[model samples]
Target: MTCPLLKEDLIFNLTQGLGYEERSLALYEEFLTMLEGKELSAEEIHDKEIIERIASDERRHITIAKRLIVIAEEYYHTT
Candidate 1:
């Protein structure tokens, strides 16, 4: 049987990573908004694109983390 404590630890780590990704999403979203119409240097423009990519990646990470947490909870209960 799977260890209950191990499941808890996995869930906790997933939750923590989820939180960080959420925060990243929020920050990037805000940064993207702040980049509106105003002119930007070439580097800043490049950064905006990078931020957009990171934000999208973080969103996916959050989704995966949430799914993993649910799976972990189910296993935790069954074990």
Candidate 2:
């Protein structure tokens, strides 16, 4: 079952989540850009791999957040 949240609460959480996801995506992109044109050190390679994995997770979080927001909207409209 879905936890009940006030309209403002739902919006607040969704806005915060999107902000986090946006920042996370930018940070990951920046990391990738920094390493893109240059040769990667062994350490850099490891960092990049880890970052890539985290970036994927961040993207998933973004999608989930978006879906939740939509659900919240529907819930509010229906009720």
Q: Global lDDT of each model?
A: 0.89, 0.88
Model 1 misplacement above 4 A: 1-5
lDDT of 1 by residue, 1-79 (tens): 5564677678889899999999989999998999998899999999999989999999999999999899889887886
lDDT of 2 by residue, 1-79 (tens): 5557788888888989899998989999898878897888899899899999999999999998889889888888887
Which ranges of candidate 2 are over 4 A from the true structure? 1-4
C-alpha RMSD by candidate, in order = 1.8, 1.7
Colliding residue pairs in candidate 1: none
Scored against the true structure, residue 4 in model 1 reaches a CA lDDT of 43
Candidate 1 whole-model C-alpha lDDT, 0 to 1: 0.89
The candidate 2 region of ten consecutive residues with least summed lDDT is: 1-10
